[model samples]
Target: MKRQFVTTENTLRFLEGFSALEKRGAEEACLMVVDGVPGLGKTSIIEWWAGQTGSVFLRAKKEWKPNWLLSELIEALGQVPRHGFEKRFKQATEILANKHEQFSMDRRPFAVVIDEIDHISNSEKMLETLRDLSDTLELPFIFVGMGKVRTRLTKFPQIASRVGQYVQFQDVSLDDVLAMAKNLCEVPIKRDLIEFLHRASRRKMREIKEGLSSIERFGAINPGKEIGLDEMAGKLLLNDRITGKPILVTADGFGGDNE
Candidate 1:
């Protein structure tokens, strides 16, 4: 499969949220929350932003503690882990502050993005640590997680209050599907077929990619046909369009499947 990253409308919204957060002064809020359903391309946007801004990016583990999180940040800053939690926390914040200063002088944005944060969202100490880091360093901290993450963070009022921006990713629209198909598909795919795949995948990014993979397979098998919904006859378009459903086996009994 061709490697591609399609910047959809949600991607633009995320960029705007971060841009707004970056423009804030030290007295203003620096923490941002991005939550949505699974497979909405939150992680992709996070990585893309991190790459563009040269920010530290980390993924929270289920067993992570405050010290582990601090150590990871330290490591990302090109430093070895310190012995104690306080030492690690201090070192990480100092490094981030220095980097933030440089980026400020260069008129660029600097941030630390944490992905898959649902696992650590319930830990009060972890949440407090993030808040402390953002406050002390005066650098933006972005948290990406599933839909309930916003509600889960509300359990910690202090942490929730520090959030300056909240972005909820919605399901991909037909236009988004078309853009992705145009960028990722090896062959030309009709607009209606793109919409069909979008609805078939339930507008989830992972499943939408799977649907594109199926289209690629069909194109390779039938080299001369223009890949479209009609051309995909006797082939699976998606695994299951809705919940508690069986696999969509084509009427002509093709072996291909989509998910």
Candidate 2:
């Protein structure tokens, strides 16, 4: 693979927590709130975990109504292949339960991983829908998205307080960035390039990876001896697409970095 994921120890620890929740008794199943900036590898981690455990993965649309969203969930369940209103719901729930003719009391419960949950973070109807499915059928589920989920959960205290684990995923560090850059590009990145990238990316993984690739391409094509800050600036200045000027960034830290 292109090594998009950083796969740090923190991510592994969070996965361990997920596994513990899944293996717990039915009554003890829990929800999770994974808060992070966009493209911080949150979705990738969830997808990888789902793949590793043979669980189903579903992403919440940027905007969705309850019925449309429910249909999307049903579609993800692999039950849309069946026709009709009556058969669809029956088949959907059945497929979600791993197609077991009888719900196994001790069987590993199916994991329903929902991403972009914060889209419906304030919608009680949507929240209640998930809560009802989990409570009535006693299903195992996990939700991943933006914002402080605890605040959103206040709308539904029943669901909010039931969350057994909460984790905020973040970007890969600059130290990890250089190694990933070296590994992916098959070339050593100069310290200045790394420092410039660290400043530009603000420790955001996707931005760092993209910045590294841009620098590597300049190195390969421009006949440059080494990738450095000036070369990177010439080739890929962080310019606002709307304005034709180089972006000026200052880091007083996230507390108040606003220009």
Candidate 3:
């Protein structure tokens, strides 16, 4: 079973561009910024790419102190000589440069996915450091952030200038959601059912997936049987009881859709 939300074309373009840069030369690691509303699956898309391309992925979190970000990178690259951020980044870069000698392709094609970058990207210093790394070392880097991120990034012209690719994740379309449901949930859906849920979900993947999950739960109770509209209407979180309509389930971030 395909346990993934389908990769949209805009996403595929970014992935292909990243690969093209890496395969061509040292300059391939130019900065990429992925901006989306919360729960749009930016991290999932990047991690999936990492698995396919052998790129190193680092997730930056809310509690991650500024220095810790650099420290972790240093440690991961086998170059943590000391605790200071600048020292560690310097040593790591040197070692990576050394390892990229004539004998082998650079393993340092590493992509540091700075998760939640919007938290610190507005900080002038941090943005400059990332910009410097991308400019000087030409490191492969990605910044993952929420809706306000792209707007925030525009504040720093220097950093914005280095961005080779920018991606804005739109909500999942109806066709894609239905396809993922039929293929991933092992449920052959009818057109009416698809329309019913699409109206309720506005085509968000998380919402549609959860609805399918509800369907699976229904099937679990009535084993080896199809979960038709009646069962869905009663047990599913989608239906509006009083009006007899499917209630729109809004995504309150974290990628899950809710009624």
Cα-lDDT of candidate 2: 0.64
For model 3, the run of ten residues with the poorest summed lDDT:
249-258
For candidate 1, the lDDT comes to 0.81
Model 1, 1-259: lDDT tens digits are: 6787788989988988987776666444889999998888899878987988898899999999998898888988899988999888878878888999999999988889999999999999898899898888767899999989999988998888888889999887778888888888888776656766765677888778878888888888888767765677656665664553533424343332334
Please give each candidate's TM-score. 0.91, 0.75, 0.76
| Clashing residue pairs in candidate 1 (N, C-alpha, C atoms within 3 angstroms) | none
Model 1 stretches astray by more than 4 angstroms: 25-28, 241-259
After TM-score superposition, what is the CA distance of residue 127 in candidate 1 from its true location, in Å?
0.7
Deviation of model 1 at 160, angstroms: 1.1
Task: Give the per-residue lDDT digits (tens) of candidate 2, residues 1-259.
Answer: 1555556644775687776776666464467677776756677777887777567788877577656666777876664545554455555666665532233544534577888887777888777767766664566668888766667787788888667677777556666666677667645567766766666665666666666667666667766477665445545624432344543322222221111
Find the candidate with the highest TM-score and give its number.
1
Q: Report the C-alpha displacement of residue 82, candidate 2, in angstroms.
A: 6.6
Looking at model 1, residue 182 earns an lDDT score of 80
Q: Which one wins on lDDT?
A: 1
